[model samples]
Target: MSAVDEIVREWTAQLLDSGSVAALVAGLVALALVLHRATWLPLRGVVTIAHEGGHALVALLSGRTLNGIRLHSDTSGLTVSTGKPTGPGMVLTLFAGYPAVSLLGLGGAWLVTVDLAHVMLWGCVALLAAVLLAVRNVYGVLSVLVTGGAVFAVSWFATPAWQALCGALLCWFLLFGGVRPIAELRRKRSHGRAASSDADQLARLTGVPAGLWLACWFLIALVCLVFGARWLLLMPQL
Candidate 1:
């Protein structure tokens, strides 16, 4: 048989033999729901902390004085300093948060994939453990756990194609989930008379527009999805 014939035959057999199509569809649905919930939940606080902390740490290490730090109830806040940050410094600080959080989650997914083909299954368990541990506020923990559970269940029960679909969906959720709340918080703070000077400073220093930042984050997340799917596909079955 020709190489093309052999390749087509293999694909045809896999498609005919594997009960993955239905599973894949189900997984996609579950992933969609999880992403929707994640976008609405108030998980931006954690992201905010990571973002501002990145700025502060980079600044301190770079020999800049740390003037002040403010965290808000909505998970969007500012880090202030006496000296004006260079363009590069400001850009780094502004863009650091999403990448940090996304990378951490992606790392977690990678670790899970190393141990289990169905990494989302373990992701669910880890999230549940975090909820029990009070790793963050109750709402935050619940949000993570619930979303993780949905993804895990879908991945575990579905076929490989479904798992890939679900992973892609969750990636989108993680990417855009925190943006709306953060933007809303910024707007409210900007107009309020009680807004701190640090808020204004934060607004100024983080000069990258919110829409642009969100787009960049989504792009990074899409890249992560591709990596995650490859990892899933390569994992050995249990």
Candidate 2:
């Protein structure tokens, strides 16, 4: 078999042996529900903050001015004063959101794995401590805990091939499963406005088509999947 086929076979064997496939499905459902609730809480504010920060960071780096920033109970917004970004820049900005966060998480996991086992353990502990210190909200704390657990579990239990499969599955779940509820919530909030004005403005300014932007995001997501799989497969065997 090819390497990809071998990986898939091994993953299936492991899943069947552990009976984790069903459990994983249940866990994903539960996670989706929790994330759906989280969207209704102040935690969404953090996501919004990250999103706007992404925009602000790119704008500043590209020599644009920050016109204003608005934070509301439900959403956060930013206005940058600059001409429309060029095609590539606009695509880069839009694609930066969750992938940036995922990359940060992957980087953190890598750092933990770089040294001894005790060092990795200590790194996880320190990260947990930092989360407790920085976040005041219980929901935020829970989110951090859940995310940390996933990282630790992937690091400790799964082989690299399994990790890659799990990461890809998780990413797919987030993009399709999580996005539906989020879009529903957004539609409710916006009174069924199909097109967001901000997105329209962005498209107009960048002169980049929305479909093209989405295609770029998909490409980046694929790259991330490959990286995630490699990280899992190449992790030190205990």
The 0-to-1 C-alpha lDDT of every candidate, in the order given, reads 0.50, 0.46
**Highest TM-score: which candidate?**
2
Q: Report RMSD for candidate 1.
A: 10.3
Per-residue C-alpha lDDT of model 2 across residues 120-196, encoded as one tens digit per residue: 44454455445444444455456556656765777578765455344434433333332333344345435745355
For model 1, name the residue pairs that clash: 24-162
Give lDDT: candidate 1, residue 225: 53
Global local distance difference test of model 1 = 0.50
Off-target runs (Cα >4 Å) in candidate 1 are: 1-34, 37-39, 44-46, 65-70, 81-83, 116-215, 232-235
List model 1 lDDT by residue over 1-238, tens digit each.
Answer: 9999999888655643443342233335534544565633454554554455556666656566666556555555566654556565555554565565455445544644464425645554564453334233454445445545665677668766545444534433343343443455456655774343333444466654444555565677567656654543343332
